[model samples]
Target: MQKQETTRIKKEDKVKIIAGKDRGKIGKVIRVDKKKKRLLVEKANMIKRHVKPSAKNPQGGIIEGEGPIHWSNVMLICSSCVKPARIRMNILDSGEKVRVCSKCNENIDSK
Candidate 1:
């Protein structure tokens, strides 16, 4: 088995949808599936999935769910400035590491 490499995007992180039908929409990252390299952005790229009737559901119905979107199609939205910005690793004097926004030079986690 091979260990998968991840890009380190986290939940509650603001992001901008850059591709697919949800292009230009901005939202917080609700989930990150590292194994699949997919992301579930809050209120982004929703689709209906039809499912057969089960014991719980007597009738088959269409389920509204969030579809997996590739991570590449998303740009990290700076929490501080509230804009889509690139992330840069910064080390504090105390050796604490954090990601900062390249655009505003503000700490992405400060917000």
Candidate 2:
């Protein structure tokens, strides 16, 4: 897939998992991989990894970490409504475009 120039989801944005095993779980966006079309959500999509003893992990047994979830599997939760909503862009009076929730028409981005 082609890399998107921009994404509606950003780090620290609160999001809700709409699909996959973690569906209905809500968490903050930890990071975004635009090229892979995935987002690392905090405490979602947990996966186990077996690692050998290393400097970083002396015990190096089984470890768990957040796995990337396809962006399509998640939706932004509107702050005002506290529910999942689709986002739309609109130009403000100052001509600055901002993301807003389609369900509530509230600003998704604080800026």
Q: Rate the local accuracy (lDDT) of all candidates.
A: 0.84, 0.89
TM-score for each model: 0.84, 0.87
Give every collision pair in model 1.
Answer: none
Clashing pairs in 2: none
Residues 4-102 of candidate 2 have per-residue lDDT tens digits of 455698889899999999999999999999899899999999999899999999988999999999998888888888888877889999999899999
Local accuracy of candidate 1 as per-residue lDDT tens digits, 16-52: 9999999999888889988889999988999999999
lDDT of 1: 0.84
Segments in model 1 whose C-alpha atoms lie over 4 Å from true places: 1-5, 54-56
TM-score of 2: 0.87
Worst 10-residue stretch by lDDT in candidate 1?
A: 1-10
